[model samples]
Target chain A: MSDLKIIKLVKNFVGMDRPAVNNVNLKINSGELVAFLGPSGCGKTTILKMITGLFAPDNGDIVLDNKSLLPIPTEKRGVVMVFQNYLLFPYMNVNENVGFALKMKGIDKNVIEKKVREMLDLVKLPDIGFRRPKQLSGGQQQRVALARALIASPRLLLLDEPLSNLDAHLRDEMRDLIVTIQKELNVTTIFVTHDQEEAVLLADKIALIFDGELQNYTSPKNYYEQPKNIKAAKFFGGVNFIKSKKINNEFISDIGKINYVGENINDLNDEINITVRPENIKLSKTNDFDHNSFKGNIKSIIFSGTHTRYKIIINNLELECSLQSLGIKNINQGDEIFVHLPKDKIWGMND
Target chain B: MGGERLKIILSLTPPLLIIITLFFGGIFYGFLQSLGYQPAIGKYDINFSAYYNVMFSERYSKLFWTGLGLNLWVSFASTFLAAVFALFGALAIRKTFFAKTVCNFIYSLNLPMPHLVVAVGMIFVFSQSGLLARFASQLGLINSPGDFPVLVRDKYGFGIILAYIWKEAAFFFIILMSVLQSLGENFEELAQSLGANRWQRFRYVILPLVMPNLFSASIIVFAFSFGAYEVPALLGVIYPQMLPVMAFEFFLNPDLNARSEGMALSIIIALIVMILVVFYFWLTQAKIRKD
Candidate 1:
């Protein structure tokens, strides 16, 4: 029963020059689900390990439940981890696996059985008590790992990409399952995942990390709308940008003069990297559209099920735009079209 | 799939043939000889006399049971000690590079030591006025070699157990290290995050998960030590006439009949180890359920 606080945690892998985790400090309040979202080798998993005391920090302290956890071993910290592989203890059956912590506590068998069954029911795997981990599907095994962690009534539950191993459809379902389950259990949890969408969908707070540094930690809305830096904007908005100069109150790039949207983050330093959204940059047959125009040759048009993305090379600048084409867009490759980009649709980063 | 199956069977043929010749053929021959229906002798005496003599001779009774008991005790005791050493060796290599390199080099040396060399090495290190006693005397820690104490050739099979542990622990360390490594860092992190203490994590996660391989390896080590001839003959002072030692002694007899009894004794020792292994399988299955 503790609120977890990490203060200036650093870990250096011996024999490796670069620090895997460099001076990471983050806090998870009680009953919150924060995600450590990063690509592989971003030190997200390593940070989780340090919190669980699986890896001792080369320096700094971890405070959990008003006590310094640096001196405490992992098992005594009251934090449970659900691994990416689900790690259900292959030699153990589901009941024993779920009730493992209680068994360690030397609890009565009857109570252990009761708690295990209750947890199994909570994970909606009520009939899987006698089955081994290998017998269960990836999703079901993930459920069991969750229940095992939750049944311990842990202070915090750390998930190291539990849904990554599942299939696409199953991954979606399990993401919802984890969120619903965490809300029901109200355990302060941090999920470590490389998948950006998984992090956005599952986390109340998304901490986007890159190269062992926290890029931005914010809610999903702010993360997309107002990115802190170029890395944040690039990852969250999925935008395409071109280096440009801010002269005559417009972005002069290879494409054309993109109308400068200066209402937000127009703080021009010396140079500007402006992003033209693929969706916002439109292509139409009308030559008279009152917008910055470029005569683009239709290079290619990819027809997705519900939408089409057009690749246009205008003035030797390849510009891509997504169209919500519902089965019809009288557009073909090698056709001439006018590309219209509104002033407000352009986002620029001061470099 | 069919071609793969064929390839697997074809690959297995050589090992299957070796198993048939070395294991089954030996067992079949022993069975025939023990029954006293020796085709080579041109005799088919339907009598339990050889069995009775092998089973109930006063020397056989005294030597076989005592040696069997001693072998069992030493094998188990040594395996336990080896397991402890392997655990320490594993933990030592868990995080530190220096400890890892030295421990690994020393432990890996165990498997490479031949029985002859191991026995000779034991003589050089553990015998009376050997390297240990010589060093102790020079250090002025002991008055004489007798005061240096009986480590090797000790009456309680302490010497055999020590040598067995020294050799087997290193050999088993490699196996144990692989098992621990294969489980990887994630599972331990999972256990700790689940609020499992170091002991609890080890007991609940690490031990339970790897127990299957560990138990199997332990039994293999057990059987190896039980039937081993060189170590017991050379270093075993607690029971000079240990089962394998007694078997060697009987086999060296001038009378051909005495050698046949020795084979029968060998057959009995093999059966006991096989039964013990079967029991181990049963025990492990139950443990798997509990896990």
Candidate 2:
């Protein structure tokens, strides 16, 4: 079992003022696919590199299966990283590239060949083994890279923005392939990406990092429904924030009072900002909910292909709400509407 | 299309003219002379006598064969050693910015120096009565300058090989540095992640990635050292003289008839370089295809 734990990992670049990765901690169970999600230069890839033993953490331990991996060399760490550019060895054919790790292990040639063929089939590129990496398309190269990494059967698989190089369609295809392979092999995997959709779609747990610190590490749903701070909420597309103050357990805002229900508000400061996802704010023509309902006027409506987004004005506060296009037929600009801010869906953060 | 084609041809005409007339024209004239054609000396007949004399005749065969051996030995040894030294040097410094900058400056310092100057430098530094020998004598490590080991003008062409290595390793280093810089550490990192140790990473990834460039560079170095005259002429011994030095000696003969043999030797040197380059290309291409 390759359960991995990173405790207070820190890395400070020489010239930078702040640490590139600072005080980040995470625990990933065996066979659990986790994503280190953040924007560019947010230390997501730095964390991945540290885990792969490419970069040593300044002050922490990376434990895999109850053993500290700090002293192990990169090759002996049994951690494989697929680089962002899919850096396949240009001199080797696809089969040779896939079998390179096994060859390094002094495995038998026939056995390597058979395993390489099986890996090729696993990545769904069985017929292209003899072709060189340059001969393959971007998606095919990505598959070859994946096949090469997985063939090593690494204790931990690290992918650095593997799908960021692919087109839209290939991204979806590779996403499914990664999930399938990660589950099939039961390897503890951590992939770094700035794409939140990819993180939510692939990872069993998402570690949202911002500016070298772990903001929140939880299931993907928690990032949307219960973000740790306004920054974490904003990163996951939480935009409708209501500036408020918690007085006697009631969130008193400009619009109205919102009853607290989701998490304990004792830790939150009196001055707080509560936010709800645009899609979570229920918009209706009539007041249906007994609590946290506000009457508002629809200021604007944008009809996208799948969803229609509406900007509603309530008590001089403009709030954005998105509804499925199918159910948003009657909604139009300048129409009065009653929007319900569900107590359970509203996430509060101290300013 | 016709206008564009004419414009391209017009642009290329000058260099093409110089290449065809001066370069190939010189080679053709040399080839005709090597075949014993000498209109200047009141002889217009073309024959294979000069080639036969250089290759098989009793008068010149021993010198020709030994000269060829020395030429091969010096060229192969210098080129191989230079390439190996440059490869290691480049790998050592490729990861460091300051070291790379300083080394690049120091390494390219010799590239512009003429081979004759390098040969003279080798003699001054490595010869029996030179600076190193005098220093060794002063240190009491050697009894006298005469006790110093012979390097310059030695029978083994040590000084000649040394001069070439000193100059050519810079060339190899520059080529290798640019290649390794462009390659970065991505492939090596990928190999490392795939469980390849240091030696395995170098053997499987770094070496192959740089092979094509290194192969082409080695070809240029090999062909150059094989045919170059200055270092070998200044530092080579008498009996097993390099082919270029021996060919120059033949050309210096006042009897103009011996010029044909000189031309034959020069043509033989060119032919050998061409054949070897083509053979090397074929061997590498076949290996690449098989791989």
Candidate 3:
């Protein structure tokens, strides 16, 4: 296990005024798998490369286990990265590829062979010691790359979109394998990806970066439920942003006024923006006439696999709603409906 | 279907007939002449006398043996040296854009320059009274041009080997650059992440991936250097001449019997090149199997 601290990291490329990685700071705890989640070109992969010493940071230090890694070369930094393409050396067979690092360190032949076999078994590929990389399938090659990376016992393991090249089914399997192996070894790992779902599924903590800046660093649930800004919120999924006014003690929107349920609502500007996730807006066939309930017509119904999404129109305002299709009757478009915006799930933010 | 098949066959017949008639016909006629069956001289009887005279005759044996040895040395040395220089040159300039342009221009500048021109350039640059010798004398490294070391037209064929390397290294550089560009930096980056340093990445990963291409390129350089006539003709000494130069000299003789001997020497050179090519393929295939 290793703790990593990235302090004020900056990297400026030529012919660009804006730095690729701007003054980014992160503290990764020991034995934690943190996912740097964002859209593409959000400086997530740049940060990973800087930590691995592939790209030099213009101004900052990466301290691993309280020692600065700037002075160490890439090979001596003990940071291993599994690239997006799973760059297994095409010329080497499975066992030789896995044993390459130990051989580089001048380990004994018998011991390296034993360790290679052990790593292969750990990756659940015990029978492919003699096969070339081309002979293996995508998932199998991924395992070989992972096995090769892990055999070195690196201080920090970095995976850069490790499953982006695999098919959907193989991506799931590779994700589970990586999570299990990370847990079993208790190795501190950083996974850089643009897929928010993958981050939410596998990361202990997700650091959301946007436009070369760190937006939020917290648990996956908090990243999804309590995004700090509108950009971070939209990255998780779709959200209905409402322009509201803080009148008296209530927040007034086109949908209606609701009691403020947030800690920073009082200190915020009179005009604010609030968001409610689509799934949180519940729908029913009959009106309960509650304060948060409003009569609306189902303008459209999109039948997805496991759930149905409805676009509801109430008082000339459109709102998105999602509900599970398992126990509900078939809700048709243009049907009269009632939407309940739960007071707890309606989140407010300052303009 | 029969008409379509006939059309395809007709489309291919011109090139195939040209190859079979012109190329193979010339090779067969040359082989027959080398075997001492020359219809031009009305010597229809086939004999091993020309090959024996070229290999072990009193008047020509010394030149023949030394020419064979020098041909092997010059071809092997130049090919190996050119490949090494080109590989290092390509690896060094592949990263930086400005360096790539400048280094690429300097290395590939010779690619279009003819080998005859480069051999002449070698004389102008490396001869005792050449530009380098004059510059060295002015710098006080030598007292005069006559004090400069012999390089061009030397007995050991160093000047010929140098000329070949100068011309062929560009060819090698072009081949290696394309290969290295296609390969990209991912493998080296991954190797570095796996705790292999710069030299290790090159030795274990880069060298193996590019070896087959480099080997094939070297074969072309070696074969061309062995069978070519102009460079050695311009830069080599009369004694201990290269095989092609010696064979051309035999052809220049007035005796018709000597032309058969020249054909035998040319055939021997071709056989050597073919054997080396087959051996190279076998070796590379064995390396692939081992991997």
Candidate 4:
């Protein structure tokens, strides 16, 4: 049980003055699933590759369990990576491909077949042993690749944007498959992805990286309720930023003076960006907002299946509010409404 | 008709014209002339003496075996050397920048240097009074320069095969390198990630990807070697003559009847290449079925 520890990791590509991954320190205990999340080119994949030894770090060390892995070659490193393309061996069928790693380890044919069969069953691909990768569907091939990686029972499992290759619907299915498989096997896992929803669904802890720097590493609920800075706040996508001045660590925006929401309430300051999630936003026709409420006109109303997604223009600021249509009438576009932003749910960040 | 619609005969005409002019016309004229219907010889009547001479004459029969046997050896030997060289060149370039640049320069240089120039240079170095022969005599490997059976115009055909490898290996190198390079990064990387060592990656991923390109390149280079003329004449004119040499000998003969024999030999060489191409296609089909 090698617990992966990456200390002061850095990777600078040739001819580029800037490092893609700079001074990153992260560790995963045995059986812990840690996810790296950010927008594209935030160096999440570079970090994962370095961990897998596909790319070497310019500076720092990777310590596994009780030993330092400086002398161990990549082939000896008992760490397997599952790429987004699945990288299935084109010439080998499911059984042969899945048993390749075991064969390389000098495992007997009888043992390899037994282990491969168990892995196939684990990834729900037991019936695909005789089929080539091209013959299987995208989802089925992903399962085979998972079986191939999992059968080796690697000490560390690195997944680089694995769900990004699938369609939107199938991406959701792969997400559950990855988290469930990782938990059941209890492999020390590191999943790198740009999808915030994926990070939220699969990670026990999410590290938000921006410009090759770690901004926040915390639980999903904490990340939503307490983003450390403006960059981390903007990446989650549907948050409304209301610019305001903080007096005595409370933001006074179009909504009103609001205090801290969930976690990191101690990090509030004089100038802030108040983030109100669409789910917490309330809209009414009266100007009865007290601590953190504002007068806003609904500029647009779009139906998003379960709720009405409203684009509200409050004075000079814009806000996104969602109203679940549970026997409620349709909120027409360009309707003047008073938006009530909850003081407790507002993550006021000092940019 | 739509503007994009293909003209049916336009695509058909070039190959059809090529087959008629290069194959049919040459065969028809050669066949008639070989039967001894030569206006130049003041005999407009057909006779089977040229074919009979080819079948019965002791000297012509010896020349035929020497040329045909040497032709097969030169073809297969050069193909083997070129395959090994191309594989090494491709593998060397895959890991280093300067090695790749140097190899690119060498292979590209080989493409434009004509075979006759290469053969002439080889003769300059391998002849009896040549630098290599002189050095070998001084080193006591041979008693004299003349004692070194000159590779040029020898029964062994060493110089001819060298020239063939020089030109055709570069051609195979370029195609095989691209095939070896474009074998996507993920398969090899994923195999390593799956605990395969470097040799395992080569055996499982690299070799399988490049084998098809190797087979195709072999056939192409073999054709180029078989149809060759200048190098074979320059290097092996004394003994074990190649098919092209035999054709040229008959073509330049003083007897008008022997000129017809040259055309028949030319047609035979062409048929050999044609049969090999057909056989190559059939073998690859069988391999695919076995897979």
Candidate 5:
């Protein structure tokens, strides 16, 4: 019941030429875990702060449960944010820190104690309640922070780079814990992260931002398969871009006539940029596709641990292609190969 | 490791030797004199008569007890008020960039001022027949300059406490500002997000986070105000004076035997400060253990 909507959000910082967050709009359903995915300084954290009422937006309306939250102060907004460093109160032990919200609400001591124990069990750290935050490891502190935030039963839980401070193993562990708790409570959550893999793996929907603007907001699969713009495609690791002109349902580029299978292909602008993921480009010994296949000489081959990367030159156009190492059997540098651009994979963008 | 340890000890030797010989040597000499050893008067003996005379003798005990009371009252009140004022001031200005810059400049201006100068300034501003008294008389608030209440050289040590608060608040403010700047607004923001209002945020997050620094600074302020002679001597009253002023009066006496009592009183002041500091640490440590 805690659906959140951000409409025409704009915030301008002093001394900056452009806004830090400009006219960003988003709708998040209740119980859905949304990720505000962007690079550093792209205003993802700003939007989170505005929602938490730490920063007031210059022009916007943030509505929670169909009620405007713009006039509410931060403490009354029913939104809690776990900071990047997990700012646990250094003076308090784990029990006091976790029970602080209830204590603030003037709840009874025994109730708070019981709830604190329950939260400790939920976070899987029942015996460490007497230790100070300084005594905990980084991952343990993160869990304590999560416990504290959840103990409040907030309407919206915002996490700012929750896994950025953890090692790879702890990151995976905390990711699972977060997903588990987020579902168990069914709280609407939005976490800001720059890591694309974390966003893709954890988010029900990813809101990609760039230069203080919403680049694209969609499901993870669509964000990768059908990026809305060239920047979104580039951010998702789409490296091979060909400047093409759309004429009569065919895209003419330096590589060849690119054919894409999608509705509204003819409705695109006259000039557009065509891009496909490197992994999506099929490289084979024989010309498998009839319309969108080309023979190219492999200029270089790099054998990574999981995949093999190849740089192929086709008609003065160098295209990067990656294939599974197990699938790449007889490919070597300086070999003639046939690269096929799948009709359903080629994406056309006007920007 | 041996060479590194030797280098560290060698580097520390100069300051250590200076402190041991000059500082501790002075205290040792003073302690001996307080125990009734006077080489200048050809009297070398160790006894407790000086301490007894200062604490129990009929002639000086009354003055000693009252002076001790005044000293304690002034030190504790001034130190606590100054720390509290500086903490609120720091918190108020920590969020604004321009205000913080301007307030920092203004606050630091008082830190370099001497206590004697501040005491004199206090007298001029607050004493009867001074600038404030004359101004009040002119403004028709009072009949004459004498109608203004006595502040400086008053029996209550208001003028002395005022001077100490004015000077020490700046010191506490500087320490608090550095701590608050380093802490930033993260803890307060976290508390706010947890549904704590303004007072709760200050009470829980801000107070505890700054407590250690404030406690240490308060200890230094308390110890200094208890022992310092300049401001109280300039602005204190005669009947019930601070310990340092009364001690200096004993040193000014012509009888050389009075120096023993003065040394004993000085030692008593130092011992009281040390005991109070230990007690403060014990109280805070007990609280920490409970937490």
Candidate 6:
């Protein structure tokens, strides 16, 4: 197991006005699985490549196990990257591909064969040694890539959107496989992904980045619930922002009025932004006069099988709400309903 | 559906008919003459006399056998050298944009040049009294032009091999560059991440991916060099000439009967090239089946 630290990393591509990656710093604990999460062109994969030594950083240092990795070549650094496409060597069969690193190290032929078999079995592919990569399904090829990366026992394993190419069903299976194998081996791992759910599901911590800068690095739960700013909040899922003014320690917005739930609000800011997740807002057919409750007409109803989403307008303020589909009656457009925005679930940001 | 099928066949028939009329037609005429059935000389009776004379008759056997050896030597050597050089050249220049452009332009500069012009170019540069010899004497590296080594028309056919390498290396370079461009650097990056060094990645990843194209390109170079006439004719030594040059000499003979021997030598060269091409095809197919 090894810990990795990135210090003020930056990369400026030629002919580009801005750096692809700019002044980012992160520290991952030993045996910790971290996910660099962001949207496309956010430099998440660029950070992974820099860590794996595929690309050089223009500034800053990457230290693995308290030693600087900038001076080491990729092969000697014991860092392996499983690409998004699972770029398996098409010329070699499964056994050869997995055993390639061992062969390069001049391991004994019998030892390589035995180790390769063990790796294949670990990836749940016991009898696929003779098959070429093209002959395998997408999931099988992903497993082969994982087996090959793990067989070398790399100090740090980097995965660049390894499941984005997989279909929905296979994505879950591969995700479980990767998480299980990563925990079983206890190797330090970092995976880059544009998917929020995958990052939340697989990573011990999620590091959110945007526009080549680190936004927040924290536990997945905290990172989702307590984002640093409006952009980070919107990236995780749907968020409803209530423009409110603080009056006599009570917040008043277009929806309704609610007393402050948290500690001392003795500051001088009159206007502020209060963010609540769509799922946090409860919807009901009848109003019980609850805290922060308002009556609204459904502007639109989106039926997404698992959950039903409603765009509701209350006093000219549009608020999105999602409710579980279980045992729910038919809800249509333009129906009057009450939206309860829990005070405890709402977060206030002053800028 | 019938009309579509007829239209496809009609579109294909003109080229197919021309191929049959020109290519196979010429081969058939050559074979007829090789079998000693030359109606031009009014020798109607067909026999293997010309082949026998070319292969074993006391008078011409030595020249025919020596020419065959020289043909094989120049073709195989030049093909191997040119392919190795081109592979390295393409690999070296593929990374950077400026280097790729400049190197590619220089590498392919000789591609459109005629084979005969290249052969004469080799003569101007490599002959003892040529440019290099004069430059060497003027630089005081040698006493006179006579002190320069004989590279053109030498006994070892060095000059002919050099000319073929200069011309054919460009063909191999173009094929290899296209292959390398399509392959990209993803596999190499993956291999490096898997703990493979530069040489290891090349051997295990890049070489195997490029081998099929390389082999196919080599077959073309080998076949062309083996049967090509002008280069060897201009640069070959007198004692052991290349087969095409020897056959051309046989055709230049005053006797009408000499045409059959020339046709027989030409047929022999064609048969050798056909056998090589078939062998390469079989080898590549077998590899595919194994995979």
Error of 2 at B258 (Å): 1.2
lDDT of each: 0.79, 0.92, 0.89, 0.81, 0.93, 0.89
Off by over 4 Å in 1: A1-10, A14-18, A23-30, A58-71, A106-108, A236-239, A247-263, A287-299, A313-316, A327-344, B1-46, B58-60, B138-140, B237-240, B255-257, B278-291
Q: Show the lowest summed lDDT stretch of 10 residues, model 3 chain A.
A: A258-267
Question: TM-score per model for chain B alone?
Answer: 0.85, 0.93, 0.93, 0.82, 0.92, 0.93
Which pairs of residues have clashing backbones in candidate 4?
A255-A293
CA error at residue B85 for candidate 1, angstroms: 2.5
TM-score, predicted candidate 4 vs. hidden true structure: 0.86
Q: Which tens-of-lDDT digit does each residue in A1-351 have in candidate 6?
A: 498999999998998788889999999998999999998998999999898888999999999989999999999999999999998888889999999889989999999999999999999999999998889999999999999999999899999998999999999999999999999999999999999999999999999998899988999887556666677778888468878899887888776786557432565268877778888888878887558888899999888999988899999989898888888766789998888878777776564
In Å, residue B226's CA in model 1 sits off its true spot by: 2.0
TM-score of chain A of 2: 0.96
Q: Write the per-residue lDDT of candidate 4 for residues A275-329, one digit (tens) a residue.
A: 8788888777776767555676878888878887889887777788778877655
Task: Provide per-model DockQ scores.
Answer: 0.55, 0.73, 0.73, 0.60, 0.73, 0.79
Which tens-of-lDDT digit does each residue in B100-201 have in candidate 3?
888789877878898899999999999998999999999999999989999999998899989988899889998999999999998998889889988898
Model 2 misplaced stretches (Cα beyond 4 Å): B1-15, B283-291
Measured over the true interface residues after superposition, the C-alpha RMSD of each candidate is: 2.6, 1.6, 1.3, 1.4, 1.4, 0.9
Say which docking band candidate 3 falls in. Answer: medium
**Taking the candidates one at a time, how many backbone clashes does each contain?**
9, 0, 0, 1, 0, 0
Tens digits of lDDT, candidate 5, B11-76: 999999999999999999999999999999987989999999999999989999999999999999
Q: What does the lDDT read for residue A233 in candidate 2?
A: 90
In model 3, which regions exceed 4 Å deviation? A263-269, A285-291, A329-332, B1-14, B285-291
Best DockQ among the predictions, by candidate number: 6
Error of 6 at A259 (Å): 3.7
lDDT for each residue of candidate 2 in A231-313, tens digit (9 for 90 to 100): 88988998898998878777899998888786757788888888899999898898888989999999998889899889999
Candidate 4: Cα lDDT at B44:
84
lDDT of 3 at B237: 95
